[model samples]
Target chain A: MIKFSNVQLGYGGRPVLNALNFEIQKGDFFGIVGPNGAGKTTLLKAILGLLKPVKGEISFLNIKRGHKKRIGYVPQHASVDEIFPIKVLDMVLMGRYAKMGILKRPKKRDYTIAEEMLKNVGMEGMAEQNYRELSGGQKQRTLIARAMVGEPDTLILDEPVEGMDIQGEIAIMELIKNLHTEFTLTVILVSHDLNIMANYVKTLSIIHNNTLKLGPVDSILNEETMAKVYGAEVKIINISGQKVIISKIK
Target chain B: MNDFLINLEFFKYSIACLVLMALVCSFLSVYIVLKRIVFVSVAVTQISAAGIAIAFIAGLNPTLISLLFTFLGVAIFSIRFTERRLSNESRIGIAFVVSSAAAILLVSKSARGIHEIDDLLYGNILAATPFQIYLMIGIIACIFIVHFLFYKEFTAVTLDFEMARTSGIKARFWELMLYLTIGAAISIGMRTSGNLLITTFLIIPAANGLLIANRMKNVFIIAMTVGIISALTGFYLSYYFDLPTSPCIVATLFLILCLTLPFRFFYRKS
Candidate 1:
């Protein structure tokens, strides 16, 4: 569980998102949706401690500050170089590095966990495969496995299915959904895909107008909020009790 | 072969120094190439060379001077550039050009003049003494131990800097450590192996290994192997053909890299 108290996030004194107040309950599959430059990634960076908040405090209910090992993060796939010569298992083994401590090599147990994580992600067959050779979907899954292999209390995924095909997106979303229940994980996902975010997430936060609107997906993802946030004519259709968002051309 | 045996005693120290320097540089090359900081090595080498030239002009110890200058450059370069106008690459490029120009000017003004510059650029490995060999071994051993102890941290930082930071690893600290190690290696390596030879050793073997190897461990092993093989064979060729040891070794490394191209192609296809 995490609480942000009047948090103001920015870079170089330029505030991107201001006066943010939110509390992420444990085991909640919380989704943060917003337009480009909405400071969603910045919020994630603030939570990850990579960027300091310009103002306010971020308090972890169960974990202390500087003890971020309990939170696993799957960064945007584009952030990593594909040509890097790392094997699948080695990339996954990197997850256990925090627990392995300094000067100590990974033990047999660590390797076993890494292998198990690969299996969970349906990448056990490719453990010895070069990571660069992996398809985009496989790469995303491998990254997810890497994040989950650490066995963290919280999992944060940024654009997990950004460049994937529709099938790839569905598979990844299903995988995350299953893993969320199976592991009882506190999932925090950031994405621009409002449709998937609307259907999957229980609670969603829309960063718009330099502030956050937090509520259930249905309330937060209506046409009015979507138009206000995205500056586009959008329609929210209820299909079989699931919310489907479609942007209309001007 | 008989000629090499006849001059075995003379060649022994230089051979040991080259092999050790090659091993160390090859190991660090993985990080350099993987992190895409090959230019940083070039800039650091140039800075170290300039430091040595300045020391030569001032009649001070060139090794210590070079190390200090290299560390200074590393510290400055490691700081994250806040100004968006000047990219890190542009900064490094400026550093490299200025250091190279300074080295040339300083060497031209020194007593030994251009010949000293040549020696700095293409080192005289045949001139290595047992004391220098011992120093190489000691320094390389320290670097190896440090890398071995912090292998995971180094790999994590090189693989994903932000991920490492989010996982509670001090990415900046490790990055500084990486730059320091590279600085120390370039400083010492450039002295014994010269700038051209050491830079080739720092880059080529790692590139060759990464071309053919899929795994990180294999890449390291293949790189070290390439380095050792190049040094030994190059030493023999230099002895038999009456060539400069540094250039001969670098040429051998280039040849080996070329030879691995087909294998890389085949491996990728498969």
Candidate 2:
């Protein structure tokens, strides 16, 4: 579980998001929906401990002193160097670096876990393939494997389905869903996609206009909320318990 | 061939020195080429040369001043360019040009003649002293040791800086460390190898490795092999043909690069 208490985030003296208070429960599939420059990156950076909160504290509830929160992060874009000629399995195995001792190379156990994660992500056969050679979806899966190989308690994905085709989006989303269930992970997905947030996650958090709203999907999937958050004429309809939002520019 | 054999003993230290310089710079070339920060290499070397010129003008130690200037240059290069006003390439280009002008101006004003400029641009490798060889051995050893110890950290930061931070690694620190080591390697190599041959050692072999190998370890193997061959074979070719050593080495590397061009067109990425 993670808790943010009165967290104010920004660069310099300008506050991007102010007075944020929320708690993400364990095993919750959470989605954060925001437009560009909506302090989503700032909040994520705070969680990742890259940026310190300006005013308040964000704490991990149950993590012990010695064992910090192992957060598996899949970035918005492929951060792996395309020109490094790094192989698929080797890329995944790098996830163990934080846990490794100084001067340590990847052991057999690390490789085993990496390969198993590759298999879990359905990229077992591509382990030897160069990352530059992989398709977009395959690269995404490899990234997922890289994150999962660290055996993280929380998995944070930024714009997971961005730039993917319809099939890739669906496949990646389903893969993330299964991993969430099987691992009982606390998943935090950040995206600007309202419909995907409505359709997939159990609980959704919306950050807009320097404010944040946290609630269950049904509570947050109303037209008024969508209109206020997105600043547009919006309609929400449920198809067989799946929510879809239609937006029109005024 | 007979003359090459006769002079081999006399030039053994220089040969060993070139090979060592090539080894370290070639390894770093992977990161440089991978990150598309190839310009940083030339820029830092230029700045380091400026530092040496300053040392000659100010009557200070060249090694110390060179390292100071190299570190200063890398610090600027290490700054993450978030602002879109001037791109990283333009910024690095500015550093390159400014440092180049500074080196020339400083050398022009120094008591040492303009031929000192040539010495700075293309070092006298055949005149390398034992102290220089020992210093190179020490620096190369440190480079290799530190790199191996922090291989994952270095790779993680170079590959995905954001993800490295998220994974609890000090991404910024490692990034700065990487730039510093690269600057150090270039400066140390510049003492005898000069800017041209050092830059060649940094990019050519690594570029070839990128062309031929699909795995990171194999890429390093291929690069180190190419670098050593360039040093040894190029030295032989230089002696046999009575040509300049640096160009002979550079030309040999270029020929190898040309030989490896087909790999780039045909080699599979996956």
Candidate 3:
């Protein structure tokens, strides 16, 4: 479980997140949806202790400097440096750094776990290939495997499916669903695609004007909320038993 | 050829000194070339030269004066750029021009024999003392240790600083480490190769290494090897031909670079 109480985040001069309070229960697949500059990335950074919250406190369950072996992260496509000439396996093994520390090399057990995680993502074959040579979807899968190899209790993915083709997107979505069930992991995903999120994410958190609306997907997917958050009308409809959203006619 | 080889026996220490200087300089060259910090090397060399000239004028030990001025210059250079947010290129330009001018003026005014000044300018490897040899070894060891201990962080920082910070690696600390390492190397090698000839040792071998090696570890190995060869061969060639040692060493590195070019082109094509 994780808790954020009245958390405020900002750069030196401008505030981005204002007095935001939220709690993420264990084993919940939560998706945050909003337009650009919604503080989605900011929220993740604050949780990771990468940024200092201008105000308030964030606490984690059984999380110490080295004990938070349960948290993993898959950043957006633009986040990773592709120029480093690291192989897919090497990138995944980096997740083992916290456990391995400085002196100890990554053990056989670590490689075994990483290889298994790669296989689970159906990317075991590309383990030896340079990471930069992989396609966008393949890269995402490798990153996911990297996060999974750490055996994290909470996995946070920021727009992991962005810029992928339809097939790639669907594959990633299915992979997330399977990972959630297999690991019983708490997933916090930030996405722009509403329909794909609706299918898998049990809970939806919409951020706008530095405030958040938290509820189940069905309850929160509505025209009024969408207009307020995105400044546009969103029409929600069910087509072939799948939730689809048609934008409002301006 | 046999007679020349027999006569060159007195140059053994010079050859050894060149090899060691090459090792440290070339190892740092990979970063300097990649990051385009070639001018930082130029600036450090000139400022340290100026410090030496000042020491001669003030009746102080050249090595002690050089270290003091080098540290002072390093401090000013590091702090000003960090505070002003100046790019490394611009800082190097400012430091290089100002320091070189100061050195020229100080050397002109100093009451010294032209031979001693020329010896400093063209580097007398035969004159490299035991103390300097130990200093160079110590500095090189420290550089190697720093890079090894923080390999992951340094890799991330060198490739992309912002990502390294977000991924929980401290960037400022590593940047400082890099600056100090470069300063220490320049201070130690300034006496061995002088300001001008040091470039051959630093940039040439590292560039050669980059051309051949794809990985950082391999690059370091290749650089050290290239540097050592340039040093020993260059010194012997100078002794046999009765040429200037600095120019001979520089020409030796330049020849090695030329040799690597054909391989570099082929590697790219493949």
Candidate 4:
């Protein structure tokens, strides 16, 4: 688990997210939701240790001394180098680099694990295919496989299916939901839409105006919180026991 | 016919040096192309050229002067600024333009060194001394050895930098190491093989390899193969047809790049 006590995250002495106090429990499928430029990424970056806090510090609760918690990070596939010549399996195997020694290469067991991950992600058939030619959904699956291959305690995905089609989005999100259940892994997902994440995540942290409200997804998905987060008049509807937000800025 | 080739003994040494330089530059070229830092190479070369010119003006050793300038250039290029006001491309472009001007102006100040500067761009491969040859072998061997030892780390950083950092791979150290090697290679490569041939070897071969192979390992193999082939064929063509060596090498590389199109076309279809 990770804890943040009065943490203020920022860049260049300018605070973006202020007065954050929260803890992500072990094996929790957590979602951080916000609109564009709402310091959501700043919070994620701080948690990832990519950005230092301006005020308070983040401390680990259950982590061991002198050893950092291993995190498997899956960035937006669009942000990756597009022109590199890499196969799907090769892309996934990059996750094992940190686990092996500096001079060590991936061995048979590593390949076996990588191939198993690819199979779990439903990409076993395309392991030899060029990564550049993959569809958005397949690429997302490959990226997920890449993240999972390292066998990290925590998996962090940043907009994993932002550019995918509707079916692809559902499939990837379901895959993530199933993985969280099957592996008993701590999953932290970042997205701009609360409704898209509401059905999958157990807990939600809604960031707005450099402020955050964290609670169970059911409590946080109500109209009042959605309006405050969006700065708009909003309505919440129940579709198959799932909360969906309808907002109008006007 | 064999006697004629044997008589061209000094020519063989030049060819060996060219092939070795090509092999070394081609190794880093894959990273350079994949990282999309082609402009960084251009900027480094120009900054190094300016250093050579400045050394000539100051009566200093050109290799040492240029190596220092190349290191400075690498450091500047590797810095990640918190501010986003000026894009990185703009900064590199500014450095390139300024260095180019400085190289011309500094060399103009030392009129006698102008011919030597021309030799720097076009190279004097046939005139390489024994000391230069030995120095090149040492540097080239070290480059190959370092890459062999740290290739996994380098490939990890190049493939996905943020992922590497998240995995606690010391991405910045690897990045700096990668740039340092590239800087050293450019400075030394330009001196012996000329900037024209060095730039060609640094970019075209990797690109050509990527056209035919989807696997990174295969791409690297093909890149080195392309470089060696061009070096040998270009050297022979220069000897037989009485053409310029540097331009002949560059032309051959470009020709091979063009020739790889069929492979790409077929690969796409397959």
Q: Which is the leading candidate under lDDT?
A: 1
Screening candidate 2 with a backbone cut-off below 3 angstroms (N, C-alpha, C), the clashing residue pairs are: none
Judged by DockQ cut-offs, the docking class of candidate 1 is medium
DockQ for every prediction shown: 0.67, 0.59, 0.16, 0.74
Q: What does candidate 3 score in Cα RMSD to the true structure? A: 4.9
Worst 10 residues of 2 chain B by lDDT: B261-270
Q: Give each prediction's root-mean-square deviation over alpha carbons.
A: 2.2, 2.6, 4.9, 2.3
Which stretches of model 2 miss by more than 4 angstroms? Answer: B79-91, B233-244, B268-270
TM-score of chain B of each: 0.97, 0.94, 0.89, 0.94
lDDT of 3 by residue, A21-82 (tens): 88888899999988898888788788766777889888886566765336777887666755
TM-score of each: 0.94, 0.91, 0.76, 0.94
**TM-score of model 4 (CA atoms):** 0.94
User: What's the chain B TM-score of candidate 4?
Assistant: 0.94
State the RMSD for candidate 2: 2.6
Native-referenced TM-scores of chain A, all candidate models: 0.96, 0.96, 0.94, 0.96
CAPRI class of candidate 3:
incorrect
User: How well does model 4 score by local distance difference test?
Assistant: 0.85
A165-239 in candidate 2: lDDT tens per residue? 888988999999999999999999988878778878989988878978989988977888877777788878778
Q: What is the lDDT of residue B169 in candidate 2?
A: 82
Model 3, CA-based lDDT: 0.77
Query: Which pairs clash (backbone N, Cα, C closer than 3 Å) in model 1?
Result: none
